[model samples]
Target: MVFNRKHIENLILVTVLTTFSGQIYLSPTGGTFRLSMAVAVLTVALIHFRKLPVMLVCGTVAVTIPLFRSVVDYFSVLDADFGDIFRSYLPVVSFYISYGFLFLLLSIREKLSHPLSFILSLWLCDSFSNILEFSLRQLISPANIVSDVLIQIILMGLARSVLTYFLYNTTLYYIERYDRSYQENRYREMIMFISSLKSELFFLQKSIVDIENTMKDSYDLYRHLESGPQKEQVLSIAKNIHEIKKDYYRVASGLEKVLSAEEDRSSLSSREIFDLIRENYQKLSTNRQLHIHFEFHCRTPFVTAEYYPLISVLNNLIINAVEAIQQYGRIVVEGRLEGSIYRFSVTDNGQGIRPEDLELLFIPGYSTKYDTVTGRMSTGIGLCHAQEIVENHFGGNIHAESDPELGRTTFCVMIPFDRLQEVFIP
Candidate 1:
């Protein structure tokens, strides 16, 4: 309906199949032209009104042939037996009616957007049946125009259907490819905006450092002034400026790399990772009481992954798990090593997922969080980006298992030793 590449192809396939119906002839130019015009008009109308009800409309419109053909005969303009010509096309008319009924039923029951593709395919298969019937009739008696034309029409219909298959699939491929390209471009633009903001913050810090150094030089020169009563006032002013500079430097240093987690050069042992988790748990504000527990069984010396991203992923997962819990509950983090792979799992006793909402969880800009007062909107890009990092950047896999009724959920991630190969940034 949106006329995407796939939809356009479906339209073309329908047009081709409809055109095949016009190849059946009654021996004269006028009769063939009239029949072709009727089928062509019907095909155009069907393309516009693509719904179950439209199929019935096509059959009703076909009834115009009898009424209009009678009027044409009154003028004696055409040179064929009108009655024989009508009977000759009666099989095609019956086939069209049956096709409409079958297609309408399937469309309504399946809620399909383009049901005619399958129906047209099935109808084309009837060509072989039509061919066999024509052969048996010709063996018993002399072949008539109706039988000969029916065989040819059936063969043409089969060929058209085969062509439809190739065209439709190719169109769908291009449509999906275009959709992915547009999305990737948008993602790159967003990353560029974030990087620019980081550069600005870095420059602002440098300017603050310069101002502090200038104030220090001014204070040092004032201290060397010859003995005078205003010396104390100058000393007090200088001290005040020095204290202000100290406070500014303290605040700026605390904020250094606030948006990112601390990086550790040494590979993290299981004990070190557990200690870091406990330290973070104790440092949480008084308003939140998050009970963190872990069960690490890995005997490996050290893992290849950096500590911060691993910690950041776990930190965010814990925070979200805590938020989802309406009351106090346990959050479990477990780690294990199997062969050359490391597996980490987090489990929470929190509000879980709805069956229908599962598929949408990892989609960018889709969130289930509701505002406390207005219950309005939230952009759910956090989990989406986190999953992207784990899968695309870390070459690991993450899976969620949730139970809404029981108020429990578990997220599992598996990282192979070969994840070092995924270190390159894109």
Candidate 2:
């Protein structure tokens, strides 16, 4: 499989940790017990990580080993001369440097994806590092360069290669299984959320219809009342009716937002989607006493797509624009077709986003609005949810540009027409 930069970095980190864990010091010869484990770790790392990180990890391990040994020796009661201690460390230093360069060379020459290629690369590097360490030891002590020592190095190299081959594959198997389970759980949660949204929409639509009828009757009775002593009472009742109507409208609008979370499987015109958003926001602005203007321009109106998500994204942008303005501002929405992409933009004249905060706006649970009295976030998921719907469901991308000095911000979304075509045609 192809590996990305993140995957490569993880592999390097894993190799470094495994190397530290597998270390075992052999007495008398001053060699490490599982030096072959480093070969196995390097083999796995080369398959995933790039040469740069591999080299860096090797350098890190080389430095860390000496420091670790120093700490251990300081605490232990092993009495040895400074010269002997330095002599013992020489072979380790030589082995690490040789391993790094030899691994780099083998990686450049071979494709490490296949097991055989990885094994061959690992064996070649391990053998060379071991030979270099043995030669270094010979220089440190004349009697160390014997036939018996050479044979032991060759035999150890073969054993390490065989051990690494088995261990790496076993570890890879468990990692893949864990990742697969995580993805499946995430998918299930999304499905359940959509199902719950559908049930809520049905009840909300029924309640909205009933409230609208009641509001119409109240208006008719208020208009027919005569101006007399009972006129004040009729007026009071009329005011209560208006207040109730506004409250129900607010409730209906909120329900529509919940409905928008589900996938819209119908073919809806761009105008239809825009009108729905405008009507919803108009009620909100009227209730809140905020002056906001909305404009939509779309030449090609009909498009086959999920209506709820599209409207939801536009609705969120408009809400954010409205909230940005402390007193009053204008919001303009424009939709146009350019080549094979549908471009939609929401532009506003409000307190524009801070330069530092602009990049973090779409992150989940991040909000700029806070209640003055309670010091709590007003809403945190608006932009995050909008971004997910556009990019994940509609195969689109969204970006924002802001001028804080002028109090102007514009958010733009671009979705490929091909994605819409696929849904509509099939």
Q: Which stretches of candidate 1 lie over 4 Å from their true place?
A: 1-264, 289-301, 371-378, 420-426
Clashes by residue pair, model 1? none
Q: After superposing candidate 2 on the true structure, give the runs of residues whose Cα lies further than 4 Å from its correct spot.
A: 1-19, 25-36, 42-52, 81-83, 108-110, 227-426
Error of 2 at 15 (Å): 7.8
**Model 2 lDDT, full chain set:** 0.67
Give the per-residue lDDT digits (tens) of candidate 1, residues 191-308. Answer: 3333233333343455466667767765776778767866766767777777777776666666555534332234555556555664455445234554444334434435444544
Across residues 175-220, which tens digit of lDDT does each residue of candidate 2 receive? 8899887775554344334433533443444456666676676667
- Which residue pairs clash within candidate 2? none
Model 2: ten consecutive residues of lowest lDDT: 25-34
Tell me the lDDT of model 1 at 199.
Answer: 36
